[model samples]
Target: MKVLVTGAAGSIGRVVTVGLAELGHVVVGLDRVPQPDGEDSAWHTVDATDADAVAAVFEEESPDAVVHLAGHPGEASLPDSLTSHVVTTGALLDAMVEHDVRRLVYASSNHAVGRTPRGGPPEAGPVGADARLRPDTFYGVAKVAAEALMSLYADRYGIDAVACRIGSFLERPETVRHLATWLSPDDCVRMVAAALTAPAPGFAVLYGISHNTRAWWDLAPGRALGYEPRDDAEDFAGIIEARPEDEAEAAHVGGPYATAQFERPALDRTS
Candidate 1:
């Protein structure tokens, strides 16, 4: 299968692109950042928000699947962030429709349900795709809107959309919260590959996390996509200091991003 990976130079993108190529899929990597030579994938520089540019790529590549990961990755002030996420996502969806590309693996975030309380009853288990939207920041809100766009396209255009509510995707667990939330790079590729190959995913929202013992998110939805995560954060659980249950970060599913103040510094606005 031929695959187009947007934001293909980012941390997760790099892993996914290489993993897809190793699996024998032709991978075309698109990003504003130019990739170094000798990579397994073919790279192209394109700002995602540009509809015409994105359409041209779609027209040219005509890929069998797309893993949409390009966006303003972190929480930021209005316009620029919105353009990077929502606007760019809209452009991609439109281009997908125009080019008749049916399969999409959207990079949604756990922050889409950021306000949910963590550590519920042990038997209750973690939240699933049916979890309510509780965006904790503008960035999360943008993901919410993009998810809606995916739904619209899937319903009206027969697009097979898989929205992955990804947790803290990192190479390693950095903080205490990450023990439950961290999604290893290998697991990230596994999940994306599942999304790409799933038989009939019309429109589904699924969690993207590893098989962590203390995971606060469910894996059942991901299983439907053929994802079987192998890495577990608990392997390094003894090394990282655990935060007390009473800490604010331990209380919400969003972690520190849930409570961060978003006021823009004066110097930042001048840029």
Candidate 2:
């Protein structure tokens, strides 16, 4: 399959682009910045927010599917957050419709339900994918809005949109909270691949995490979509430094994002 990956230069994007290619898919990269040296995929330096540019790329590449990972990766002003996540997603969905592309594997985040209290084995039942939206920050709100767009497009256009609510993506578990939330690089690839190839998944939401022993989210949804996560954060539990903040971080599904540090005025006064 020919796949287009947005934000191809990002930490996760870099991993996904290469991994998909190694799995025998034709990978095409799109990002605002120039493609990095030594990478071989067909790269396009176009911001995802630019609908015209994004459309042109779709016209040129004619990819079979898209893995959207482009957006502000952290807390930001409300307008910026919406443009970065929702607007970018809207543009891609439009282009996909125009170009007859039927599949979209979105890189949604756990922050979409950030305010939900943590629950899982040894504590309580895991949070299911159908949990209500309780976004922690403006960034999280943007994710939720984007997800709604995906759902709308899927229902109206016969598109297969799979939203993966990713956890803490890192090389290894570095903190106590990571033990329950880490999404290993290899597992990230696995999750994306599963979402991409799952037969006729009309509109689905899956927690993007490894098979962590202390996971606080349900893995059944992902497993149903053929996403068999292999890595476990428990392997590096011995190296994790337990900190006072771990308790608060583990208190919610989105960790620190649900804390006061992310609180901000809904409207940007400076603008």
TM-score for candidate 1? 0.93
**What C-alpha lDDT, on a 0 to 100 scale, does residue 167 get in candidate 1?**
95
- Which tens-of-lDDT digit does each residue in 1-271 have in candidate 1? 9999999998888888899898899999999989856684677799988899989899888888899999978987656667878898888889988888889998999989887887678777688789889887777777888899899999999999999999989888977888889899999989999999999899998889899998888999999789999999999888887566327776788877677564343223544
| TM-score, per-candidate, Cα-based | 0.93, 0.97
The residue-by-residue lDDT of candidate 2 on 1-271, one tens digit each, is 9999999999999999989998999999999999999997799999999999999999999999999999989999999999999999999999999999999999999999999986545555788898889899999999999999999999999999999999999999899988988999999999999999999999999999999999888999999999999999999998888899988998788899999888889787955
Q: Which candidate leads in lDDT?
A: 2
Candidate 2 regions with alpha-carbon error over 4 angstroms: 119-124
Top-TM-score structure, candidate number = 2
lDDT over C-alpha atoms for residue 227 of model 1? 96
